[model samples]
Target: MKQISTILFSTVFFPLLQPVWDKEPFNISNISKPDAPFFLEDAGIKEQGAYFRQLPDPRIKSRIALSLLKTNNEKAVEILENMLRDEKNDNVISDLFICMYRLRDKAKITYSERIKKYMEHQDQLIRGYAAALYFIKTSDAATILTMLEKENSLFVQELLWNELASKPKSCNQEDLKKFLQSKDSIRRAGAVRVLALASKEPDSVPKLKKAAEDELPVRIALAKALKEMPDAGNELIAKLAEDKSSIVRALVASCAVSDKRLKTLVKLSGDKDWEVRRAACETLGGSKSPEAISALLARMNDNYEPVRTAAEDALVKINPGEDTIKKLTEFVKSDAHRDAAIRVLGMLGAKNSALDILNVLNGKAEDETVRRAVEALGRLECKSAADAIASKSSSKNPAVRKAVAFTIGRLGVASTFKTLELLTKDKDASVVLEAINAMGLIADKSFNKRLNEIVKDVKPSTSSDMRAYACWAVSRINAPTDGMMEEMKKLFLKKIIPMEGEKTYDADYARAAAIMALVEMGGKKNEPSMKAAKSAISFFHENPFKTKDEDSITLKEYMRQIQAVMNGTEIKPELVPTVKPELVTGKVQ
Candidate 1:
């Protein structure tokens, strides 16, 4: 049990530090999305016309959403539509779909086959805009159901169901009730959300009772729908909390709490399934009741790290400032949960706990516990702990050495680069890599000549974590000489494939780093290699194979600007596009 928990704890990435170049580690719930359609504030005909003239290509419709606000949207519709017909960039096409959708009323368009075609586009963002435009213009329930049959993205699904509820004349309640019994699961689940959304109290409540016996997805949908309806009553939430599937109980555990519901949540906090207990902890993070604190603090020693983390977040929220500090301070001094408490105090930026952790570092704690203390001090940004942390660099355990390297870099002082440079030559490969990467965070140019040699030594496309971060680290050192650009053109531009045992996510990030370096080095005029590299990146942004974060395409638009610059055509920042706010998908899962 202890071994399993230790491995699980190592895998956890806290909602912690964010480097400007990196997006949060990818999770479906927090995927980076395309920019919403932007309308420059107070845009008028002159502003639109003036801004329009400056675009490198007025046909790239994404850049001028606000600039086009004053142009007769009717005439503008024809121009934007023609431009998108041959467009290839998904982000660009997404911007086009939104631009055309914005002009729908002025163009007097119908819910025609063309709109349906756009709805079926491969891009999630594009499909969402098409669905929204469809929802606004069509009054046919069959049309809504047809789209629903083919779509399953929670973000898009939530949009369709909620719109179905508002447009009473568009779809009758009978159509949704019939779908509840449909053989297709998406239809069955959609029906639950739609019915619950349009719930007419006592009458609608009876229609949903049979859903308890439906398939798991449908039941899960039913539970989520109730979350939005606070007046739906704790009895309903309490019933779902007793669900046979831990997933259903977890979803129900998140519903807004009432006095009666709090008792149910507290009971669930001790649930047999750790996930159910975790969900209960997360849901009750907002409560101030003493019971909530007691249940959460008890979870601090949980076998699963995430459960303990969820509890830590709950305690911090309920007892912020000195109250939380006082609770956690005692937790660190105790023999129980020593590693977790030490790291969490750092995560919470407990300045008062800094000396306590430093004391642990100097003690005869276990190696793993010593490692945690180093990481905790790093998170706390304890510059004063520098000498003390560096003293652990020669520990026989490589893991301890790795943590020492990480914390030293997080200290972010130029003086520490000499220390990091020494670790870069460590016997252990991982320690060396961590040291090299850590040096990137510090703003010193003195190491570039040697760091550039490391970039030169890499075998292209191997996708070594060191290779990925070496590319990342090199960009920060700012050596944009022509000689380096020549090497990047010959090497870094090759498709950086994941090494046999390496993660694809790191390889994908390596691709971003190489392009960022080249963009700074300045692209050669009309270089086919550069253009091909740009196309590859656009697809990465459009359809990341296994890459999780949207930031995998962070350099897409900026690269576009660089390409334009290489061609001697300058573009304005105002023309960069974003998705329309109302058009962004939401609220499904």
Candidate 2:
């Protein structure tokens, strides 16, 4: 009687299981909900059904169906039924079946009869989807495994294998071993992954090795599996490292760092392929051995920039002692390695290393090299070099002066404030900008009058950038007098606001600085100033200046603060005025 029922069900539904590929393409855009008020009891179902009908792509429709079914939406079953009746695409039917199978437990009675019918259908695609759904609903691994072995469609086999692997408790050793030996590469890969995750027993190593000999993906799987099985031999990894495929070699280098074969990884650092070399470098970076350090240093000048950067990073990770420092210092004399060595000295943070950088600064080094030296001194915070750095503030070259101003600010020596103040009047606009930024760092009240003078000197000849920096410098001073506040407001309303519509880069900068200054003065209380602040926000938000210049950093920061104040929140600490010096470019030391 049961056999007869199965036969009857197949006879009724087999015609519906025909692949839809031969039919006219279903127009997804044409699908719409019935306009007649056929109301669903659940409002959420109506909404979801409406959304499902709007999505022309079947893939998205399947996803929506799954989500609805997971929430126990019986209406979702009706929606899928409508789609199945209206659509004839095989792929669409397959996707719909998968969605139904996923929700089978919640709606088993809803889909059980159809599943049984489809499982017996002549169409391999339908049968595949039905078989997968049956196994998922029943946890009938034995039956599914039987179906999987006979399944010829790779897609169906994949669906069955994935369903089997998802329930690891249902997987047994014999079935997994058979999957590994299967002609399908995906099945083999899936089997290896499951075995590695579920069973780390030593006896599984040989089976994994045999599977590893199959192809690139399977070999990659074996490499990952080896990570779980510490007992796996290094011989397999060594063989994989020498594989002709660079992708396999790179993976082996990346994942096999724990293997005792450090020498093999070191050899791979010099690989012809750049990615393999980078992977080797990354692995070597974590290795504490002296051999890894030597290999990294050798590749520090690799032809590929990324490879060289990787090697440099690895060397830093080694955290070399005085011997390596001495070698690096000697290597610094070579023009090729001068910049890298200077940076390395900064990273080492050794007090004595500052002397090497100082010597380069005092000598006839290139402008770029001197700039690097200035940066290194600041990183080390070599306060003793403050006087020497201050001396360069008088240099005729603006680049040198700019670098000096930033370095002095970074060194944070009280005596250099005088020099920074003097630099605020420097002829070069960039130098003056950096100098005002430096004074903002020190926040010396003595510069108040000087900053005020710069703000007042908003002549047409004076660059708007200079005045913008002056306004920023004035705001940075703590507890400005009432008179200073009035002067700043006048500068914003008169000089800055009038230029807001000019649409030049400097005009945008001036307006942004002016807005920030106004917010700083008013806080949240001053109604008139807050009203102007809102206007400024609307102006910038609508005009939306392009963030393409160095000043954009400061502009974006000010915008954030203004918005925060308007929304009644404390200003973020990073944006609050402080003495933390940051690097800016223009001059060398």
Choose the strongest candidate by TM-score: 2
lDDT of candidate 1 over 449-499, digit per residue (tens): 556565555444222455545555655665544555444443434432435
Candidate 2 local lDDT, 1-589, one digit each (tens): 0121111111211111002111211111111111211122345555666666665676666665555544334555556655555555567677777666665544543444456566655677778778776776677777777766666777777677667766755767677788877777777876776665566452346776676577877777666655544444466767778888888788767754553768888988999999999989988988778788788777766778788778777777778888777877875676677767776677667567788778777888776667667767877889888877887777777888888887886787987878888888788877877887777666678888887777666555566666666666655554455555556555544434235455233454454455665565456355555555566566555544434453443445546655775676775433112211121112211
**lDDT top scorer:** 2
Regions of model 2 farther than 4 Å from truth: 1-45, 48-171, 184-187, 201-204, 224-235, 259-263, 317-323, 334-336, 363-371, 384-406, 413-440, 445-589
User: Cα deviation in Å at residue 64, candidate 1?
Assistant: 37
> Weakest 10 consecutive residues, lDDT, candidate 1?
1-10
Pairs that clash in candidate 2: 20-90, 399-586, 399-587, 399-588, 400-587, 400-588
Off-target runs (Cα >4 Å) in candidate 1 are 1-195, 200-224, 228-231, 242-247, 256-263, 286-294, 313-319, 366-368, 395-399, 412-418, 426-433, 444-449, 459-589
Report lDDT (CA) for all predictions: 0.64, 0.64
